[model samples]
Target: MKVSCSVVVFALVFHFFLVTGSRSPPPSDSVIIIGAGMSGIMAAKTLEEAGYKDYIILEADSRIGGRVHKGQVDGNTVEMGANWLFSGGPKSSPAHEIAKKIKLRTLYSDYGNLSSNIYKQGGGLYEKHVVESAFKVADARQEFGTNLSKILSSKKGGDDDISILGSQRLFKQVPKGPLDLAVDYFYNDFEEAEPTRISSLKNTFPRQLMEDFGEDSYFVADPRGFETVVHYIANQFLSHNNNKITDPRLQLKKTVRKINQSKNKVIITTEDGSVYHANYVIVTVSVGVLQSDLIGFVPRLPHLENELPGENMIFVTVTDEESRRIEQQSEKKTKAEIMQQPFGRIYFAGEHTNSTYLGYVDGAYFSGTFRSPSDSLYPLLGRAT
Candidate 1:
């Protein structure tokens, strides 16, 4: 599903003025970007590069990186969210390019090695032939699920709400015994984060990581943490001191409480009782947050709507009817929401908004920057293809 990043603006437009928590008047801008994650920061950088600086980024967390955060584990810096950068996609991942430009350390991880290390419940390693046979059966079942999904998705109107389990049963590849079940869990449950019984075959089947980005997945080994790339991107547009963004354009720890949209503009109220006015608003919060009641909308958002393999740190993904439901309208929603359209003056973006590559950092990058004209970002942001 393709969507364009359009105008976003808020609450009943009027000349009435009221006392706010801040002694100073609330600031207004051409755009108010919610969330300082990959998508939000990219949007800001795009605007900044275009010489359009009338924008402010409000991030709820004290830090700038959202899910792409790093934590100290025993003295070693470790990624808490996204770690692997799939550089070999049909279109090279922009994140991969940025990592190279910034010289972020990375190590190639062979996920196939994971199978060789698998052990039995008692701790003895499984025989090579046994492991191979188990995976072969699992692979066949996945192929069955993929083919079945294509058949269902090709239906006249759209897809039928069917779980992958339904197709698996017909394929007669039911897992038997502990080893078989373990392989099943590895291929199905671990990959999709949902049991086949509940996973929508049409939406979740057909793992595409290898198909799109090749077999190699590079693990970020940067001492600064995987999120250092985001800091590097931010440094491009915002002034920074000692790796910390010191620019006034980026505001941290500002939790937006409500967004009121009017015909003329948008009024955003934060938890601190501070109000902000903007002609456009780009929301890049996670799907989990949007599905939650964390931020209220004067006019509730409109309705709308996968998993893949390869050392994937992201357990959830959202697309198509599934995308619209996860994004605009909530339907058998998961932790991830895929695509979203412009709601009034608000434009939605994030990894979830990328249908083809949802759940990846590169997805969020492209969603914020390189969409084609048919499905591009704001005119001010421009398009690469």
Candidate 2:
């Protein structure tokens, strides 16, 4: 609880940011946020609601919702990784403003808890009206590719950019047996653990195609879990009680490897060498942990340019094994040759850099709440408190 000495926050608030897109505000407030999950705890809870609580988050797991985690099964406390929150009520933003300020408990999930007892692949019992007619031909080929992507974006052709294996090769056809391969294993192996030929049918698919939580799908029956909306948003100022947190500005394992930055500040270090200085450094990890380098910057940092189509993609896109050793050392693309610009004291949050709720938990809470704090530092905090 001590970071207001003018400023020092290098918050690489995990899920990260623009890469080279300048935003400016460093030179002080000492921020070092690098992923206490959910976009570095909503970018240090929107820099402690703009007054700037002199930040530090740095988590590398030993727990703290990076993919919005949580385990335990038959004994309950579910959600292993970023569970549903799409189409929630009262316009579901900020996870329905913290699930209606902590009332929490939700229900309505489809698919993953798929009932009607259908089983096969070796067992038997598979009918339920032929898996509801192959989920009505996979919801009429995702509503005829969302009406042919709004008639090819009314002519210019963009949004809903195809892919569902390019609409099964533009409707030539594929899934036709074992109940259309269990409705393609419930929209590609249980709602995208991948293989709909690089996902994205009608945008992050059905529910997370966002329109402010429309087609309804809410899980989190909150048996005091679903992180109780990250412990009621980290007990507001983070000390914590019944849930036991202890806050040293939420450190956790602090694994970060090497950042560096300079021209004024930035440093970072970790992996036990321990050195943490900051002017501003928000990274928010995952584009599969920045293509699995596991953090090491020193002047070599220009990530984020994944777009994704498929030549057998893994990590949900390229097909993970470190993207099959980055497609056997290159079929090209590592952001073409790196550096696409985006760095002004570094910044980046998540939901794959969010466009319009890009991968949802409401697009990683709108990429960790986007942030504010700089009204030219409020005239030096009105000339020091």
Candidate 3:
């Protein structure tokens, strides 16, 4: 897949308007960016930096930062979503850069320590050598799966639909005893949020977190909250007072109910019965939201098809298959059905739309900042000259 930033988008749009020099759609021929999450805010920032000011951000929630949110617990701030700032790769993620710029406090997650800390069912620590042996076997199994996946991928016109479970069975590495099961759960279900029975070996074998962003993961421990990075990004373009966004361009508590589009402009209707018109729109809502009937489209969108918790606190992350089933009834191949292409004047931006790093914070940031001209609605900006 081609990789590009969102800056190319609004820059082209600015050039489009300037070169055309058309003032026909009243002065209100502006841009409307839906959602105040990472992607939306970054898109707005890119627009402002490109000298495009006639834009508004309609946020469904009362606060900004969408899924990157926080909760108050015992008079202390705690992150409820997206706490890890991945920053070890050769390429720096924008979110990690923002965290550093703001000097946000973070703690390196020593997942490597898990082996030493492994405990048996009785709450007694497992024998050190036993733990080491289990991990060694597990690592070998992972390597076997990875190598097998590569072989399967390289085969021409062959079914690469091997499940992780099948790989484990073929490698004779199926976890049987309680100790083995514990290690297997930690190695597989804990991370994928799904058992190996349903997850594709090709997809699960190559750990994207380590491969894409490197091995380091820093746990955000800022008193100001993880969303502070988002606020800092917002402050760069929007007005703020007392650490709160006061920009009139950012409309909060506005749940978009319908999006009506025409050849020349797009109309957006909020849940509060307020209507907004714009020349173009950037939709940063999640894939689930798009699948649901929560927002109606006058002309139906293209039929592209379309975590977590834990802790001692007991947060359940539903399996990916189960989540997809709940959101979309049909069990069809989801990745193929997902069409990131824009419909009419609406452009889609979010982590889910990002092919390389989907379901990741970096993906959301990158998608908001850059998109290839082919995948984006840059051509729709009338850049013909």
Candidate 4:
């Protein structure tokens, strides 16, 4: 059945000393941040750090924490999305620092003894040794992107850094043998996307950049509930004086129907017909939402109307019984028993992304900063039309 509810609209405008007389100034030359998800919150925090306090965050959901949803399931807290911090060292990880500052705990995964029970396609369960041997064969048979390597190593250069078509070509170069297929599955598993569909340039360039930064393979260490991290960040914005930061910003249960923007101000219309305005607006809605036109833009956002990144989402779930079974197995086999399950777009983050500690709290924390944007503002405006 279709259900509808009226959401209470609230605006908390954080006023600075620059504003003279007006209680609610006519959309001052301040910034308005849309969505309170990780990107949005980080954007707001970045602005605050940069000494900009006049901005307001508009959240369509009834609560903050966009993809970082967490709750109790079978007596254990589980994250619905965004679960682990990858390579979150002090110098490179903002999410990790935030967690430390807020006193959040983390659980580490032991990958050294990782052992997975293999369920073959033909119904029989293979021995762990057999599966490991197969995985190694698959790894060896995997074809590297020579074409991409050539382009990256070239002088004249190509149109875009990477192309979907180029990635598709590289995938085709690898033979469709069992070993090749296994390798493809493994890489695709981590990417959460089909090999042919993923961005070859984007993936390669990022790895190259990381290498330049002295980072080797990806690392997943601390895992914690992502929701806790979100709440911790949100608490910072709230003032200790009256427990108020702005005038009560953050609207829940309200879906943005359309956005009308001009150089002077941005007017956001909710699904319920109510309208809200701000001086400058930062759009942090998901690429999926944008692709579906769930939120419309008036005078239309030319640059953001049609184009979006080629990223997919993955979701995962684990029960207490399952966790126990793995622990027991780990003890008996003297091998780390962990479950690595991958789903689409809706990732189950917070201590569950790794095989060593699937569905643990740290998974969500690790995932929060995985694809974190460099500058929140740049991501908002960087979408191509």
The lDDT for every candidate, in the order shown, is 0.67, 0.60, 0.71, 0.45
Off by over 4 Å in 4: 1-28, 88-91, 101-105, 110-116, 123-143, 146-150, 153-157, 160-183, 193-195, 198-201, 204-224, 240-247, 304-385
* Candidate 3 lDDT tens digits, 1-385: 1111211011112333334434444233478999999889987886775556899999999999998989999999899888888867776767788899999999998878776787777788988788889889988988999899879866654535587889999999787888788888887776665677866676555766457567688889988888999899999889999998999999999999999999988999999999999988888888667656788887865343111122101122347886867456432233222343246687777765554555667777766765433234345443421
Residue-level lDDT of model 4, residues 232-320, one tens digit each, is 76667644334223435555666777777665566878888888776656555554465577877667543333233343221223469
lDDT of 2 by residue, 22-82 (tens): 2245323667878876667776776665556577888877877777767888898877766
State residue 92's C-alpha deviation in candidate 4, in Å. Answer: 3.2
Clash numbers, per candidate:
21, 49, 7, 38
Best by TM-score: 1
Q: Model 1, stretches more than 4 Å misplaced?
A: 1-29, 302-341, 370-385
The residue ranges of model 2 lying beyond 4 angstroms of the native Cα positions read: 1-29, 32-37, 42-162, 174-218, 223-229, 232-237, 241-278, 283-331, 336-344, 353-385
For residues 1-385, what per-residue lDDT tens digits would candidate 1 score against the true structure? 1111111111111111111112233323378889999888987886565445678999999998798889998999988888887756575667788888888899987768656767898889888788888888888988988888878756654436466778878898778788888888777676556676766665555545445655467889888887888888898889999988999989999999899999878899999999999887888887667656699988876441121222122234456886676565433223222232346677766766664555677667755663522132333223211
**Residue 6 in model 1: shift from native, Å?**
24
On the 0 to 100 scale, the lDDT of residue 228 in model 2 is 66
| TM-scores, all models, native as reference | 0.77, 0.33, 0.76, 0.60
> How does residue 329 of candidate 1 score in lDDT?
41
